[model samples]
Target: MTTVAVFRPADERLDDAVALLESLGATPVPDPMLEVDPTGVCPREDADFAVLTSKTGAELAEAEGWDAQTTTVCAIGDPTADALRAAGYAVDVVPEEFSSGGIVSTLEGRVDGARVEVARSDHGSDVLTDGLNDAGAYVHETVLYRLTRPDGAGESADRAAAGELDAALFTSSMTVENFLAAATERGVREDALAGLNDAAVGTIGDPTRETAAAHGIDVDVVPERADFESLARATLAAAE
Candidate 1:
């Protein structure tokens, strides 16, 4: 049986990844690398637009009682766009690729002079905000959550070292960094990461691919779209 490891920290996203794996007839093993604190705050206002880069960010905005009334919600990709719609927000834009760069490119010509609020994690890069600002949008960012490495990083590393996984999926650069840090803490960083080369090493996009490459791990698969479904399909294709 082919086993896929999901490295997403959030339970909700991990569950979605596992479900996608099952639908593809692959066995999924949860190997969350980080934990999310869902109670962070992202200041929301009746802006002309809102940007959601991750499902966690979207959830945080919804929790903060962000009114979607006549406001255009732009998501990084389809999955995040789905989340925004589920939260009763009008999804105005969804990039074909799901990355900060992709979101920036999609909004380059569209957001000029627009008041846009971005909801995201505490430690995320300023690429989106900076890009929007450069494009003449009045951009405000609010941190909605924090991500910490999981406590069971050692055991997770052990599983990887034992070759129990056929592939590992990384949705973001942060996930790659946290996974490596966890493995290093367990003294099995090399072994755990080396196991990935034998199987399919999947990334969501270019940024994540760069992160994996920085650690000397080559990414074998990158989906056209940065969603779990696309990642799963790419993983299967790479495995083939």
Candidate 2:
């Protein structure tokens, strides 16, 4: 039986990945590699536009009393836009392609002189903010969450060593680092990575590919876009 390991944290949003794997007749295994903490980050205010890169960022903004009425919100993809809309934000833009480059491109002509505030995890890349700044838009950033290594490293690594997973999906570079850390902690680094090689290694975008390659693991698939659905379809194609 083929088993697909999901390396994201345990969240209600994982339902899509779980359902997708089930539809492909692959065993679904939840091997969360990281955890999200909403504390320890500050929020910013007063901007022409608000950039939301993840659903977690949306949740954080909602928690921090950010009103969407005065700010035009931009989402990285449809799912994030959905989250923003549900949070009562007026989502003005959602790129068809969900990568940072796509988001930047979508905002090129749209935000020439606008002050854009970016809300994201503490360790997130600065590609969006930097690109926006270079495009003549004043960009402010708010780190609303932090990602930590999971405490269940041993168990997750043991499952990898047992050869139960046919593949592992990585949505971000942090996920790659955390998964490798888990494998190292369990003293099964070689076995875990070998299991990944035997099956498939799925990356959401170029940055994720770089992260996987730095660990000497050749990524097997990268979706055209960086959304969860695109990554899942790429993983399924790689499995076939």
Candidate 3:
């Protein structure tokens, strides 16, 4: 059986990833590499619009008692939109392309003079902030959480370096960065990357692809649709 490595944050998404891999006849290795902890950052209560790029940020907003109903909510994609909806926020906008650049494109002229609040991870990209600002929106960007790789991250990288893994699924750019950081910490960065080269590399979206490329990894599998099942199918196809 082909062993598929999933090194995402240990969250609600892990079960879905594991199940998707299993349904596709791949052995799922649930090696959660990262953990998300709240940084206690909160968005402004008087903002006219709120932005969410990831489900983690949405989760944080919900936990922090954000009154989403009073603010216009925008999400980058379906998953984040779904999360915001589940948390009682009516998602007003979801960019068609499901990316930060997409958000910039979608909200181009509409953000003028709007007070926008961006809630994301501690080290999130500033594309939305800059884009909204350029579009004349007053943006207040807040870091709702931080990502930290635990010891299991290094172990997962070690397994890959030992050639025990056949494929790796990356849902976000941060996962790639954290995984590589783990490999570097183990002093097997080059060897781990080399071993990964022999395995199928799967990415969920453009951000992950760009990040993987920056790290010199060629992505072999990409789904036309940005979803877990599509990614799983793409990974299986590339592995075969």
lDDT by residue for model 3 over 40-147, one digit each (tens)?
Answer: 766667888888988888888888888866788899889899988888889999988877888889987888999999888877677778888999999998889888
Query: In candidate 2, what are the lDDT values of residues 1-240, reduced to their tens digit?
Result: 567788767787567678877887878787777688887453566788888888888877887888767777889877778887888778898888787777888887878889888888888777887888888898888878888987775454566678776677888999888888878877899888777777777899898999899888878999887777778778867877
lDDT for every model? 0.80, 0.79, 0.84
List pairs with backbone clashes in candidate 2: none
Misplaced by over 4 Å in model 1 are: 40-42
TM-score of each: 0.90, 0.91, 0.93
> Which candidate, 1 or 3, has the higher TM-score?
3
Poorest 10 consecutive residues by lDDT, candidate 3: 148-157
As for TM-score, the candidate ahead, 2 or 3, is 3
Q: 6-60, model 1: which lDDT tens digit per residue? A: 8876577778778888888888878887788876565577678788878777777
**Candidate 2: lDDT over CA atoms?**
0.79
Runs with alpha carbons beyond 4 Å of true place in candidate 2: 40-43, 154-156
Scored by Cα lDDT, where does model 1 land?
A: 0.80
Per-residue lDDT, model 3, residue 12, is 67
Clashing residue pairs in candidate 1 are none
